[model samples]
Target: MSTCGGEGPEEREREWEDAAEAVAYDSSTWPPPVVAVCGPGNSGKSAFSRLLLNTLLGRYKKVAYLDTDVGQPEFTPPGFVSLHVLEEQTKDLTMLYLRPPKRCFFFGDVGAHKNPKLLLSYIFGLYDYFLQELYCFNETDDPKKSAIPLVINTSGWVKGIGLHVLSEILRYVSPSIVIRLRTTSEGKNLPDGAFWLDVREGDSRVNIIEIRASQNSPRHLLVKKEARMIRDLRLVAYFRQCLPRDFSVFSYDDLVQGFAAIEPFQLPLSKIQVIDLHCQISDDAQHDFLAGTIVGLGSSKCVSLSTECPFPWCIGLGFIKAVNIPGNFILLITPASRRLLANVDIIFRSCIVAPTCLLQLQVSDEVDDITDRLRDL
Candidate 1:
């Protein structure tokens, strides 16, 4: 475990002043500036966001997709961003977050790692995350800021105060290109903008990423261990009017030098559609991320859930206990998701989503008695 092989002359002038503060692009050109693209969950960060938005706007430039990839945001292309449910009630059962509606759009739903803000006077409860970093570095309501490059699609649940609020929003609204994609199984890499450190356990910048702490890689290996686990990630430099999003925080091994270019990449079944949720899985690498298709939610049956795998704990790592929970609410299936819901009009296009809309009041009359006992059986 020996690194820092060579460097002096003030550590190569602080590594060329951290690579010119990582390509500062305070927006100037045309609608081509804010490039954010982060990584971690299922780590393909949306197939590197469709390979960097069809390789920088080739698929016709209106490119928006702002799900901000919050927690576990799925659905892509279909007119994007809609669901904004947030209900709370502990003991009597009622909890759901599905966020992302304002503070700069794209939030369809999901937010539950809860209590984790390093300090600086609780950054005033992140007033809706500093109101989307004040509309992503407001340069007159986003003149695309430093130039139409707004690429933020993060959320793979990082620690140390959300990686120092993503490095104080890249030093406050300064992004021209901070593309950091990471998906590792066992590969040694890092290059696309490098500072994703999360070192601990007798740390020593652990060579920037000895991160084999599996279940689906989470911590940094070293970009200077993000200033000591960002000291609990200091919520917001003791809060004072917030303003920050400059851009540049990476560590999917600093940008791919290993991890075999992110394995598990196979979704092209014409864009992969298989939602047969009669889940009672016995995963051999999760039979293609839980096959798909199946519905019923009055009393929401089908419960195996061994600790987790509801899909957004950032792609259910902890390897999901080899999955096969006999916990009840039965819905088990496998002959290929029962032949991909063997069509009952494609299982009536599937519907059973009560993780919380406050269960629309404990399941609106039990989902109309489970949709009239699933249409009289």
Candidate 2:
């Protein structure tokens, strides 16, 4: 079906109303804003996602970027959503593609926007989950109801229906940040609430920079010059759920040791090593690995993508060509994948893989210290 407006005006209005009525949380009790970014493919959702984290990290120690694009997840570990205090993101250093310091979580949703059946399913599933957990309409353990600042990177398949859906999504998305690409013609007219500084392809550099200059709030924002770096070896943990049925390769000793320290989605030790990729880094590998790899929560059978997955059990993801073992160059299996390719040179960039620990921010007293540090910036 074409992604265009459909049905009668009355029906359309009714559907919109139904959608609006569905999310009826009290304003005072509603969770923090969940920001989602949607634009045509190649509009640069990935790089901009980092911009969101980089800007917020100045204010927050921990932040999360969730990739709901499904087909093309941007924030995997390693080269993909690589946010480790690898280097400082400052005014002097900020460029088109600069590495960021600080540990922010990146998760990519497998069945994101392009897949309507899957997308709608998850949406309804989330709604049901929200009702069960928050509304208590049923007895269930649904965590989507939990309040967290969620940033959804959407898919780009332009059409009226997609735009309509995009608009509807915006209604639900109380964005603390939003980045949109203006065309060469409208580049000069880029409006408020959009974070992208770079103008569109057809846009002249003059207007683009002007639009960016308007967003000069980052000047006062604290930029960490020397940030701590972490590399999470636990990224292998995502393989359990994302990988396929009969595919795995792992060291018995390493598996045992890794699981001892951090469990890989409770994978049965017996089922380990089914998906073998020959190359295995030592457990005590020098740095945090999360920066350059995908980490999923429920799965532990991924091939390690260049970014991070949201669930923590990644099950599957892809990595750069250099990281792949011989023979299976363009590999895909457990820790299976969505093949969104990037330029090769960016792979060598530093990664942050250390596991993150959440400090309670709801408590004002303790959080005051962190806030004070930020205000000074």
Candidate 3:
């Protein structure tokens, strides 16, 4: 084994451009090119995927993105595996803006180490949906003109069970191209060649592109504190939808205050069922446990709550401000419109939680005055 000198940012950028161009121009893949970007944590998988997406958009009218990184998803919030059809190019690669996915499934947790099977099921479902709805059945002499190419942005978990999950995804999707970003830290990089395939598989046709990961990348080191802050910021941004477009929130503290003052929607408890995906809660303790927690608002055909119930279609997420057991109603805050809310028949609670700052209220005098006025009303 030999080691080489580190490459500069320019060289890395060039390599990324070359890889993206290759995927965009590759004519061999029949059902439009399906590209998968995979690597260990903080290895620039998301950055490369975005570049590939932008590059592909230059040639194809529309490209489908399958985001499997529930911890830090590209389009939707954490705890979801989603597919988005992007017709327009991403204006700024640095901006972390949220977009509604064409289809999504909330897995209720950030990492798949606990429930890899469930995560894989959701991912497979999304890929199948993309094939059926977007890619397959669109026949034309010029495949590029009709068929939408898919770019799969995978999770950073590359060792142990994470690796197993990645292998399953590769086997199932069998993408035309697999780009693995390599880091100088050999321990942090995935195994060479088709790491997902077993020795018996023998000479897979998947075009493998290996590029040295950029050291200049800000996320090169997976710092827990930084990662947690980023997740919290993303959550804040998501919930900020509850505010009016003209409303200004200049800082995190301001956002917290805004959330504290925002009026929440009240829903009759009888109309909706609640299920805890992570664990079971006693009937008496359900309300207390749910208060101030973030939950998935889903539409389900089943009226009763049961572990056996099939996963529902997640309409959006809501923050359970209060669970008024006495009133037989719940106060929730969400960005989902009333039209979408009307179909929400179930609430799924997962490991995802509202940041502590958002929950702790330092009531301002204005808020107190408003409360008194409301009470008088």
Candidate 4:
């Protein structure tokens, strides 16, 4: 592989143009403008979102970015709807690194269609926190006081129930600017008018901006490589922080070696309750079910087994590296802060699963042997 140099002049020019568009629509009102980027898959929604965030940083002290796309998240790992505050510009959005979000809720599933109602509740809760706590106006009399601008990035799924979920999110957010991207295919675009207007009749308060994708737009090729592969790489990149920042772990083989050699933290099963977010299974099966599974570490005071209770706040993601059923302990590997671990009261087993390729181990043997199973733990 060849090492690339700095950004070319053409790339700089296009970024400037995209930033100018965002600057033009910035509301002159007292509060910072709220912007939402929506479009179908590979339509440059993430591209446009990064551009807008860069522009907003020039105007506001900090920009609040709410990522609703769990499959291909911008700032954090997959299976989370998170809010992040950006104080500096992001030169490259493609590079996956570890950064703690200001607030996050684990959806577990990649697509919202699995549980739309629960997804909406998480989005609303984040918005409420932004409004009640992070709002810049009315809370302070200092000159530096100002509401932080918001930028929302939606998922690529834009048809059927996915479209409805987007509409519900728009209704709840009521953003000041809606940047909708369209591709060459007309059928893939959203409805002609505002899809969320039905929620509030005769309310066209939201500003709509239509953007057409260029030939050079970034696209994810799911056929050549499965989307799950990218997700696994992301998880590896995040957990690789278990190693020193100076040491590099680039490939799947390196990750497997690193994970296998590292010592895992043992959590007492009696102190924390384990609940499957998607379904209820027999107690006998929970042990094997949780082994090698990605789980959400929750810190809320109320950890209910029933689904009626709202999903608790997820502090971070953890993988059950090993389950010692008879010993009444589980070994977990996570990047969560040590302070957050003290408050963790329950572990929610999410639908998110790490790919097998990242878990496969390489065994050194001089003699020929036949084995179908690869040892992961």
Candidate 5:
């Protein structure tokens, strides 16, 4: 929410306007430009992406946002790769997290290091959906009503396998404008040039722009939020809404305490099916593995748990407070709407876990270590 230069709101508008002009100067010719914002951590990618989105709103009715940064998603909670079609203009991108995503995939893990291929597949699948279902190529239907432009916000790990993932994304999405933010530190910059073009040939030329990190932006990558704190805040913000609206008079401690006192929603284990995408565990151990963990609730068309179910359409996520194999029941805590939760038939043991801060009894730093080990399974 912080902007560099401490400039007035009007001054900031001018800055984004300049960038937008460069990208969409000829609206008729370059109607909807697909832009991907990428860089190392704390390089102001999120802020810049918002600025670009705001600028584009002046020209386009809607802008499609493909959030690939599961560790610190701009719109949703951590551990999801989601695609949201932005219809309303947002003042601050961070302030737009209240709504659920139009579509999302639960990757379970915070980062793609463990399963880059699956992450890539999710991104590609979302993009394909956008192109096939959302995009409007015909000029007759009304250019003003055409499919929204896409802006991709990537994770900051732009080195090693991270860089490779970004490269592969560029090759796959083929955004018309690629905005790469570079911090003062040269080492943090992504390799110079259009790296995605190293071995691949594209039908169109890709425009690459490198920008410096904002001067007044918070030092989130290094100091302000250490990854755990960011994730904790995201989870807290999400679950805090589950409380009754009249029950708003409380401090964070009071909220956490109140959350713990509430009886969890119980689901019969017989009617629900559990699937783990990353590892294979025996049926006997499935309940044990799911207990005291965060899992995604979804509805799948498949009938049998004997074979792999198609990728589920996640309706919501919940923390498993207790699992009783003997009783064939699971106690869960989640803030999702009751209507959506009613249709839940499948549960995914994903990489996502409630932060230790949100847990009733946990040390401040225990979740990072504990979640790492759990995700590795």
Candidate 6:
């Protein structure tokens, strides 16, 4: 695990290394360790989680990651709580490279403050999915065989409702180990020792390890401007997949131009249902509101207009390039495979808006040619 910039790399290494060793090699523990990393904003929680994940990869063939930080998720884009099974070590943890998760739910907002309960429900659902499908019991006596360990990376918002949400998560998950990163500013740090546990609980058994947050890396301590830029870059990177694998983009402008010219999928309005998670839109306004916005592409056996409908299994994201009311179809740009798109019957609109640059691009006249060549499904 490399440090961005920090005074005590050796001490940080020792702290996480010891935790990793316990999780990977400790046979006394029956089930594998469920480690939850929590802290306030810019407290190196993500970095530590990545380091711990890489360390565990040395011992286990696969490690499960429950990413609850929708604002800046580890494996998926913003506004998603996902569960990912990582089989190989991440070469560069610093890079925000998007990877498909085994299971995920789109919360439709960057922050959990909008709908904390909904967010937690999604997190719990993903965790349950992991426990049922990916978590190994390790009944075999062979030393080589072991249960897959889980690393939970929590959101940076650790105050007020965020704190309550964290406590609820701790209560539900009851992880074997809780690693709390200590920020330099006392005001920003989480409560000391088992903070999530109530004082009335009488000495919680959950092991708590506290380490100083890395100070050297400016990126780790993201300001509002940098954070916004990173999110935008991530969105652009995700949409860039729509281009040909052999296509060469010389710069961001070139990439924007590529997206502007690319042919978008045309889906009949009757074939898909739209649900806005944040606000209500009138039937007449649905098409206009969805145009030029990022939407969660999902598939469900049954669809409901109610916001409380059982969360749909989101396949991926799509950008609504246009709303062809005359044609009774929508022009969408997404990188999801054709097979996955075939089953998409629900479109979830959240606050996850497309980057202004991509949305502002004027569709080239070539788009009509491309659209004409590609048949509407």
Name the top lDDT candidate: 3
Q: lDDT per prediction?
A: 0.29, 0.33, 0.79, 0.72, 0.73, 0.79
Off by over 4 Å in 4: 1-20, 23-29, 141-145, 214-226, 250-252, 301-309, 361-377
Candidate 2 lDDT over 190-304, as tens digits, reads 3433223233433322111111111212322232221112113223433333434444446555443332322112122222222211123443441223222332222333222
Expressed as tens digits, the lDDT of each residue in 213-331 for candidate 6 is 76534454547777777788888888889998888999768887889877778777788888877666776687778888899999885332234326776889999877766556777
What's the distance in Å from true for residue 300, model 6? 0.8
In model 1, how large is the Cα lDDT of residue 30? 46
Higher-scoring candidate on lDDT, 1 or 3 = 3
The runs of at least 3 residues in candidate 2 whose Cα sits more than 4 Å from the true structure, single-residue gaps closed, are 1-33, 77-114, 123-148, 174-177, 185-314, 317-377
Residue 60 local lDDT, model 2:
36
What tens digits encode model 4's per-residue C-alpha lDDT throughout 1-377?
11112255465446445544554444564467788888888777877788788777777778888999988888777999888888898877565555688888888888887778888888888877777557657756764445788889998889998898899889889887787766657887788667877754875877676656533344547522656777877887777767667766677677677776655666777677777766657766877777778888997763433343386778888877666555566677787877778788788878877766434523222001111121222
Name model 6 segments beyond 4 Å from true.
1-7, 136-146, 216-222, 280-284, 302-309, 364-377
Comparing 2 and 5 by lDDT, which wins?
Answer: 5
Model 4: lDDT equals: 0.72
- TM-score: model 5 vs. ground truth: 0.82
lDDT of 5 by residue, 143-170 (tens): 5536678889999899898998998999
Better of 3 and 4 by lDDT: 3
Name the regions of candidate 3 deviating beyond 4 angstroms.
1-6, 138-146, 216-222, 280-284, 301-309, 361-377
lDDT, residue 79, candidate 5 = 84
